[model samples]
Target: MSTVLTHVTDELQSIFDRARSVAVLTGAGISAESGVPTFRGGGDSEIWTWRGRPVTELSSAELIATDPQLVWEWFDYRRGMLTSVEPNAGHRALAEWERRFEDFTLVTQNIDDLHRAAGSLNVLELHGNIWRARCLRCASTFEARESPLEENPPRCLACNGPARPDVVLFGELLPDGVFERAEEAAARADLFFVIGTSAVVYPAAGLPITAKRRGARIIEVNPEMTDISFIADVTLLGKAGELLPQFLKERG
Candidate 1:
């Protein structure tokens, strides 16, 4: 290992050895490492190009209420692409780390179910999963093996209202209880890691700051610098898949 890697590994090792509570915040970058495309990178553009318009223009409750089929088709198209990818090594490393810490929490902004697919049990999904859909009327959620309803949006089994992907869309708030738990985890963390996130998205962006304020040592594990990199006690710059396993294995 290089001198830089050795120094960072020792620093992280010291913290992990002593930490009783640890929290990780992940974003689209992490998922992208495992073949998931960035927003506006590919998948998102296709969704927009499908109708010769932007998804942002139609990604609201009003749009869902007005033209549910259009919204469902967009999500269905994305889900179809998702079925072809699998979790990468970074995901597996985090899953293993979850077992190493009794109080470890993994908070992610990704709507993909890749973390769960990688065997992470205690994930706090800030954005709801794409593989699941929620009823707009009855508020019941169901899983879709393959785009639950394709040509037309499905109706709630109970109330017969429109069912939509359970994600936090353009105008919707995050699912209940997710932010609360994430905030609490941040506040009490002995060690906090912001992994693969750009850290620009608000409310979610406030989490690492919350951890910093509460005295948790911050380590950022991203291949590139983010808005929050200036605040990190240690920023190990590289892909989470390449850096994380090495960070864990070589840290002394």
Candidate 2:
């Protein structure tokens, strides 16, 4: 192993040995390795660029309310994409860590269900899940195992009203309870691992900083430098699939 990897391995082992409570934050980078497309960069834009809009634009509240069919079409495409992909090694490593740790929280920004599919529990999806839907009228929620509604936009069985993906669309507030739980986890973490994310998105981006302020040691694992890299206690420069397993092996 290179000198940097050796240093990271030693640091990670130290953290794992000492930490009683841990919090992990993941982003599109983790899912991208599993065949899920990311929202930025060349490859990402090529796949999603046909829409001629940013991800935020496609998921805006105005778009969902004014042109529901268009939104559904976009969601349908994403759903199909997610169905074809599977969880990667990085996901499995995190899930394994969850089983080993007495107190751990896996916070993910990706809407893909790969984290859950990899057998991770105590996951907090900061964005939302693609497999869930909620009524626009009554807010009744349901899990769509096989796309329960046939209508383009779908409708709630209870109120027979329009239903949208349960994700946090642009301009829409995050689910109240979920944000609170994520904040609590961040605040209480003794060791915080930021994986695959650039730490650019608001509120969610503040999580690592929050944990840092509370005296949590922040470790960043990514191939590229992120906004939080300077503040991180250790910056492990590598793909998460490669680095996480190494760190876990050291822990074992």
Candidate 3:
């Protein structure tokens, strides 16, 4: 192994051996490798040329209330994108880690459901999944089906009113119960890993720092340097799918 990998391997082994609790945060880059399109710009046709819409415009709470149809159309497009993709090697590695480590927590920002698809059991999705919908009236949540809705917007079975994706939209607060659990996990972690994220998104971005403040060793695995890299005790600069397997091998 090269110098960087050698250092990272040693650091990870040391952390895993000592840590009773571990937390892992993942981002879009990990899913991108699994054939999901990057949110760089418009539709697939203008992949490289077009600029993408802001998250706020696409997910504003106001937009969902005032123009539910528009928001639903946007979600439909996103759903199509997600449906075409599958979990990659990195996702599987995390799932395997969860199986091996009894106290490991897998936290993700993406709403693609790839982590669950890869067999991860203990996951906290900071942003909600697109595959699930929630009733705006009764708060009942259910898995979205492939069939078309009869109305412009789908109605909830419980309340017979409009239902929206369970995801945390722009201008909407994060799910109350989920973040609390993630924070607790971070605070108790002895080892924390940040993978595939830019570490720019708030609240979620603060998770690693929370663990760091509590004396947990931080490791970053990414192909490019991000804001969190400076805080990481060891930085493994490579694709997560490739790096994770190698790191685990070194541990063995």
Indicate which candidate wins on TM-score: 2
Between prediction 1 and prediction 3, the one with superior lDDT is 1
lDDT for each residue of candidate 1 in 1-252, tens digit (9 for 90 to 100): 112232245656777777899999998888888777676432342234456767785567777878878888888777877888999999988998898888999999998999999999989999888887788888999876565354357766678787887888877788899999999999999899898887788789999999999999888887766678778887778788887676468432
Candidate 1, superposed: residue stretches over 4 Å from native: 1-8, 40-50, 148-151, 250-252
Instruction: Give per-model TM-scores.
Output: 0.89, 0.91, 0.88
Clashing pairs in 1: none
Q: Per-residue lDDT of 1-252 in model 2, one digit per residue for the tens?
A: 112342355656876767889999998888888878876652443364437777667878998989888887788878877777888889999999898778899998888889999999778988888888889899998876564236867878789888888898989787778777888889999999899988788888989989999999888888877788878888888788887877566334
lDDT of each: 0.80, 0.81, 0.79
Residues 5-44 of candidate 3 have per-residue lDDT tens digits of 4234565676676778989999888887787766642224
Clashing pairs in 2: none
Would you give me the overall lDDT of model 1?
A: 0.80
